[model samples]
Target chain A: MSELLSITATGLTKRFGDVTAVNDLSLNIHCGEIYGFLGLNGAGKTTTIRMLLGMIRPNTGSVSLFGIKVQPSQSSIWQRVGYMVETPHAYPDLTVRENLEITRRLRQMSATDAVEKIIGELGLMPYANRRARTLSLGNAQRLGLAKALIHHPDLLLLDEPANALDPAGIVEIRNLLRGLAENSGVTIFISSHILSEVARLATRIGIVHEGRLLKELNANELAEQEEQRLAVDVNDTVAALSALGKAGIAARLDGKNSLIITDKPTMQHPDKVATLLVEAGCPPTRLVVEQRDLESYFLGLVGMKEEKKQ
Target chain B: MIASVKAPDNIISKLVPALWVELKKVQRSKTLWMTALAFSLLIIISGLFMYILKDPEQARRLGILGAKAQIFGGSANWPSFFNLVLLMVSLGGLIIFGFIFVWIFGREFGDKTVYDILSLPTPRVTVVIAKIITAAYWSLALILLVFVLMLGLGAMLQLPEWSAATVWNGLGLLLGTGSLTVLICIPFGLVASFTRGYLPAVGCIFLVIILGQVISQLGNGQYFPWTIPMLYSGAAEALIGKVTAPLGLISYILVGLVGAISLVFTCGWWRYADQT
Candidate 1:
């Protein structure tokens, strides 16, 4: 199991003076798996990535890449791991090609044309000669991804990879990362505050809140866990409530002249709800069985966690 | 297939690529040209001083310009010109060389690109060494430029005492003093790393320059690393009138030791310190 995992972090905890940045976080991302590390700002996502890259030492526990211990002295491990933490930065004075060339040389990549190849692949050929400082925010993010993917490492850790990107660029990056994972079997541990973005790309999602992993689930499990509610509007709201009460059904008015039903049977059977409301002399005007989105689900989890703390 | 990078058995293999990257960055920056232009101005001013000394009567007839030239009071000859060049390099080297070191090390953090190189196949220590080597190369190149420009001005002015012995001695002193000053500026790299920016390291350079003057005045310059280059340049003897003793081997050893320790600390900070 350990051999099959590309990243294994056990009981990782990091504290900065009086503040505990990350607390008892553990994760195991398998090879070729796209793991979405979902967290809001200051949720220790960057801190955890730093620990995984051996950039910062954890107060307790350890991290390993390819089953080898992660330490600054373990220079060999970095060759297989590529990462971009936070907003990616490039040498502002150097051109896009020159910046990539420096990365190639420092990476000891013998292929001389690797810079051009990455540029073409990242659709940066038009801006190849332009200085990094002159490139737009989206182009800069592309350049960052290009540098990370230039060497094609097996494990790529990216923090907020879609930051400062337009909708088209975000989709381009999403497809690029998905292709890398699906075709090349690259294990990607991507951190982002955008849950919808991760929902569309990640196979497994881990929600981190207040320096702890609040939840971890696969796409299907996440969908199954989404809270479902049946919403119905009728001509007579008071009579609809009376009908539901007489029929021994749990329902309430949502303060907007609509009845909200959260019971599993009622939500699974909206037709029965409509028939019940219709027979009570209150015809249904509108009906909807709404499933909670990943964003609200994420916020709800965080809100619940905060509520527990309070 | 992912290509594997071999671990370096020696420093040279690791240093080559890192050095290449550092040199490319330095080559593309405007700071190099700005520093070069400043050196050219220094040489031109020295030439103007020599022009004034060549004819004291004509200089005095020019009013305030003549009086200001008198403050430079040395004879308009190759020996004096050589001493002037050495004096400029010795003091100027601290500001210029220290500036180069601070910028090379601090710009990464300043520009927020430090994270890019932190996790590469090349060791962080190799990168630190490469930056130091680049700073030294830049400082020496500036000194060489000053030496050649001074020679041109002296030849054009047709000053006397233009012997091979004087030129060679001047060349040796400029190179030696510049080299020592470059060596002394190594700690600023550590300072840049510690402060994580160029502004603080620039402040450190000014502090070192002022302290160098104060400690050299206190007559304990031979023991201070920062003051050794100034004293060895023979400038302190002329300017301060107190530093008369010739620099011994101990002074050279102290400079070398301080430089070596600073290099180690810079590398250690890169290797072990949490670059947050």
Candidate 2:
């Protein structure tokens, strides 16, 4: 209920007949923080976003925005919150400028030039006069973002906002969202399946799998927890294993015929492992330190790797 | 710091902007032009039928006339022409006006844009009301277009039996029938919202039309909300009894009641039901 907490949901659950879309979920997002909601398709990410936006009511529990309970009849709370639930959609026949203009009027912004300003900010000026149906998917996503940001809301909830964007467009949106949070104190709750995208932008990240939040971590903590390993290529595998074992370093051979050392000591000092291997008369052919990427880390966190194994 | 300005917390303050947005959307939709063209074509075809009926014997010699003139059912004059206009409004207005309501509400779901409008500074009820207002306004515009064309075409063909009183009475009947037809079509907005698409709403319209005809044949047309307008326009009085007997206060109340109930349901759905 604190004012500083822009979003608070407690025991939120939604059921569609027999299927539970969101189950016993609770989370808090503070102001000026970009909270990345990472989940696979149908992991209840969009459902949770819908609940937050009051598009769908929870079967149980509650959601409060800016310390006020969210309800469909409550209009004042929405003035400070902007959201794009799933895929961004606009009236296909309307031009980009006209679509943004509609949002401006509906948001009740007195500024007549708000549409033009958003167009320029989202780099949509080139296609401002073009019909939405005629734009490519990437441009359509930009128009959707433009509509959500037109009023410069204090809170933004975007669901898979970078769905159809190209690489550069994704980076552009990431920078835009990051800037909004840092410069304007906008609290953002963005959901995406792309771990690298969220890892790069989110101040705090929540991973949801199977209608449950598995873990929550800061960006720096996620970075520090990324798996690092010392890989060694030696002439003789038996001699290298014996040498590393004699040195009290646990080492195992990976599937690709390379010795993999994931223990903290050897991973911290690959040079020491190389010396041990050379002194044992097994000259090292390749000694390298490799870190696991965000995708692998995310897949591991969500138990997707275990599922894949089964 | 990002300055936050709260929207005024009143229905009137919310309605203006919501109505503006609804008007803009309607202006840009192709459905508006499509409906206008369909209605215009019906008026022009009715005028053409009247022109052909003016002189059947000479027209028979010209090979342009055929058994189609029999369908006119009466002499080619201002009275019959106005009656034809009334018939068209009562019959065709059901589909055309129903289509306007369907597009105004169904297009939000069809285009998958309902979520965008659900969580805005304007209340969801305001959005629903705005759509209803837009549908009514658009239906009225199309009705006016049909009336103007009927007048101009009647003049050009120079049909006989023209008088100021006839024109006034005919205009009044046509406007009354059009309003009644529009009123009944409001429920389709609820159907569209419930079905969440255009095809289902269109199916509902056709089903209502068929049921209205069947009910009228059963001699109970006056009591049916869909058939009351047709009966009031004298479309079904030949088969049924006097229009006034069946179309009592209860009948008008039924039509208004259907509209009121449908508006309540549509607004309630928008405000309470889940968008998914």
Clashing pairs in 1: none
Best by lDDT: 1
Candidate 2 per-residue C-alpha lDDT over A92-127 given as tens digits, one digit per residue, 9 for 90 to 100 = 999999999888888877778788988999999899
Model 1 residue A228 CA deviation in Å: 2.3
Alpha-carbon local distance difference test for all models: 0.87, 0.85
lDDT of 2 by residue, B43-74 (tens): 88788778877878755765644456545555
Candidate 1, after superposition: displacement of residue B241 in Å? 4.9
Report DockQ per prediction, comma-separated.
0.62, 0.62
Candidate 1: list runs displaced more than 4 Å.
A232-246, A252-259, A268-288, A304-310, B4-9, B238-242
Query: Across residues B101-183, which tens digit of lDDT does each residue of candidate 1 receive?
Result: 99999999999999998888888888998999999999999989998899889889999989999888888888889999988
TM-scores vs. true structure, each candidate: 0.93, 0.92
